[model samples]
Target: MKFERLPFIMKNLIRYQATMKENDWNKGFDLLRSIEFQEGVYKTGPMFFSMEPAENEPRYRNFEFFMPVNFQVEGE
Candidate 1:
């Protein structure tokens, strides 16, 4: 799902948590994902781009990112 540009504090927290063990990192990530999910899935925010656009349209373009609901089994 699309996420708003995380605030500096939140970003720092996430980065710090990511440095932990694998299971711990997963737990933190899962918690963040759940919070985002509960807040309504879709969001629109600024993202950085390095390429020069042919026309001026805010350096970033609006993007629609979504999270898959569930995993599918083979031959479901």
Candidate 2:
């Protein structure tokens, strides 16, 4: 694939992960679940998320998100 052809792709899914915790384990779990992943339904626009598996730690919970973004070219 040619590098210049990269821009032709309009959007792509970007994977994201975060291990968050306030103080306790329950709080962290609640916080992670409380996130409103609207999937671009309201005003945020369309979003594509990845459902990859993740390992949980002792205290904090792991969160994964795949957001849609426009293609970008380096040093364009």
Candidate 3:
């Protein structure tokens, strides 16, 4: 993640968790709805893994600016 986006991500995470703690189900859902978790693609062979924003969700499309390049090392 980029340094600039880190704060926003962290703040959202904390707020989301806090809402959950306060039994604010609606707010928590809203927070989750606004946040997007995207999967990162590593260009090493055919390996794949789950990403945060989910494939179809677009709330995080703006945050796509923070997508990291897939760097792979030899032998896992």
The lDDT leader among the candidates is 2
Question: What lDDT score belongs to each candidate, Candidate 1 first?
Answer: 0.32, 0.39, 0.27
- Residue-by-residue lDDT tens digits, candidate 2, 15-76: 45566542433443333233333232111334432232235555555555443344421210
Q: Give the runs in model 1 whose Cα sits over 4 Å from its true position.
A: 1-22, 41-76
Ranking by TM-score: 2, 1, 3
Ranking by lDDT: 2, 1, 3
Query: How far in Å is the alpha carbon of 60 misplaced in model 1?
Result: 39
Q: Per-residue lDDT tens digits of candidate 1, residues 1-76?
A: 9888865421211111222322232454455456445644432332221222223454433222222323211210
TM-score of candidate 3 versus the correct structure, residues matched by position:
0.21
The C-alpha TM-scores of every prediction are 0.26, 0.32, 0.21
Whole-model lDDT for model 1 versus the true structure? 0.32
lDDT of 3 by residue, 1-76 (tens): 6555344221112112221222223453443334332222322222121224434544432111121224422210
Report the lDDT of model 1 for residue 5: 84
Cα lDDT of model 3 overall? 0.27
Residue 33 error for model 1, in Å? 0.5
Badly placed stretches (over 4 Å) of model 3 are 1-15, 19-23, 37-76
